[model samples]
Target: MSRRASGPTEGAVELRGIVKRFPGVLANDDVDFSVARGEVHALLGENGAGKTTLMSILSGAYRPDAGTVSVGGAAMSFKSPKQAIEAGIGMVHQHFRLVQPLSVAENVLLGAPSSFRLAGNATEDRVAELAEAYGIRVNPSAKIWQLSVGEQQRVEILKALFREARVLILDEPTAVLTPQEATHLFSIMRKIASEGRAVIFISHKLDEVMAVADRVTVLRAGRRVATLAIGDSDKSELAKLMVGREVMFRVARGDHEPGAPHLTVDGLAATGDLGLPALRDVTLEVRAGEILGVAGVAGNGQRELTEVIAGLRPATSGTVAIGDRDLSASAPAERIAAGLGYVPEDRLGTGLIPSLGCIDNVMLKRTDEF
Candidate 1:
């Protein structure tokens, strides 16, 4: 397939006829994608639709089995991420790669060639200037561990900008951000594109794509489905193109009567990892045959509440009862034995071991049974 540029400007980054294969899966099957200078091009697809693989190939994390890459209309080959960075292409992945102990400036300039000069506050000054220019609000001297999730994300973007990246690829950038933070990020993306750089935004959010992108490309089952200008498309059409079928915007749910209270918590209090009060006198109850959702901003004690309920963290003060049984002081195993099934947010690391197979992971909590 011929590569279609997102706009009238020359291609800032182009991947033509790209093909990548894993052991038994074709990650990218002759895919073609292009992002023009000063354009915010969004990439949309379902899970395992090869969006990441295609971006990985472009970012030099993986070599294409068959394809061609071009930057600023100049054909080039990159064998490593360093090569890609030198070529003015940078990708900020979903999970950040910053050092927790290092400051924002230190993490941004950690592996830069010019960072070996042993300069004093020059690094922090430069970072502050860059952040100011891009409207990225972050304290350069703040440690990564001390920053919020949104601030850490800004540091990642600062890292790319400090490297002089002309083609910035962001993978699921708003997944961890609040609505307000996501809006701020959209402004930053627009600012970057206005500076004659290209932004390839990879996300599954149709509304955000409609709001921020000039054009969007849909990939289905590892092949390019279609690329349409934002003005020429709507959410419904984009949804159909993404999954190769019509998508329902809403689903009908049957009404059910509430039964006795199954889970109850009163005056819950807990401290965060940094010894700060996370949850303060929170109270809620969930009745049987009903679903309750706890909604809050990213760092607002949701995890702490869950941990306290599951006995993973000590609650400073609270009464947790599961069907009339007080289990706030119970151990994790005892809570599990009391019919509590806790699935942590970090699924792979906490809920299940990645290296272990399904059966082994399933038997983790039932080791004594074996």
Candidate 2:
């Protein structure tokens, strides 16, 4: 049941012939993995390739039907996420799990025992100190709701670092980061590993993996296909490993000829559950052959404005017109029929169905348009 890499590294965690099933699909089958301590291992795979599934098992969010997991030569079975967390395994999801109403420090120290809570100036002081120490900067007393996307991420990493996590797992950490922020994070990662903690980084960015990983494990269709050292892998080679064979990283587009507005919005407003207006009379329009980019620092009126336009959420007062149709009274499905193909911004939790296949998702889009 055991599969071995060419050589062993210290602080090693091993998984042998793991198998997991969920109703119609076998998510993992005879999967094997080994990660050395103090090393940054990059997990590579396509969307449904079982990388997330395997990590979920390791993080104690799922259990393997028939397999063995051993850390430092000791066999262990985890029945829950808490059990795994207690065993020094910490996971930061692609989308963070922070409470927006809470402060940065509060979000970092949300779980764990009661004796850890701090108030007044001490909590803020410690959080600021810890964040700066890791090269991850943030204002501790600032509410999570106000922080930028990158800042929130720093807080997320701080959560694991503050816990003294020996094994830190980050999923798609740099997906939304600016290039500068990404570089900074990689530097911090190296320093963390230098302290003898294992880091498991899951990402689709080939260059980042090659840049930051000590070794790379390629998973395809729920199977471990290859494990290669960083020195032995290239972006093209790694991309092929994740997706099988080759891929063309290009998008097809036509000439940049602009046209009139297909949809228009002005003075739109919507209140949240707390009765505060989330969107405050925003105005915008999208034209044919032109791409309108909404630049914001996150949690602005972007989502609320889009929802109002898409007919998902009703606006308190405003004009939303789809080619002069005045779609303020229309439904979400109606907006699509009027030539608005909303791909949505949130992929997980709000958009993608975890259980569905690639083909099935494509089918959904086609059926919706038809």
Best by lDDT: 1
Question: Tens digits of per-residue lDDT for model 1 on 1-370?
Answer: 1122445476898899999998878988999999998889999999889999999888889999999999998898989988888888889999889999999989988876563333889889989999999999999999999999999999999999998899999999998899999999999999998888999999999999999999999998899999989889999999999988899999887998999998899999999999999999999999988889998766789999999999999999988988899998888888887788889998866899877799999898878788
Off by over 4 Å in 2: 1-8, 98-110, 113-129, 139-149, 175-179, 252-260, 265-302, 316-318, 345-370
Candidate 2: RMSD over Cα atoms? 5.6
Which ten residues in a row are the worst by lDDT in model 1? 1-10
Model 2's alpha-carbon lDDT is: 0.81
Candidates' C-alpha lDDT: 0.90, 0.81
Which lDDT tens digits does candidate 2 get at residues 1-370? Answer: 1112344368557889999987877888899998888788988888878888888898899999889887667788999977777677788888889999999888878884445567777767777888777777788889998987888888888887766677888888887677888888888887777677888889878988888888889888888899998877788888888888887777678668778888788888897656778888688888876778887545556777777788888889988998878988988777877887766777766567768898777677458545
- TM-scores for all candidates: the values are 0.83, 0.77
What TM-score quantifies how close candidate 2 is to the native fold?
A: 0.77
RMSD per model, one decimal:
4.3, 5.6
Error in Å for residue 283 of model 1? 2.1
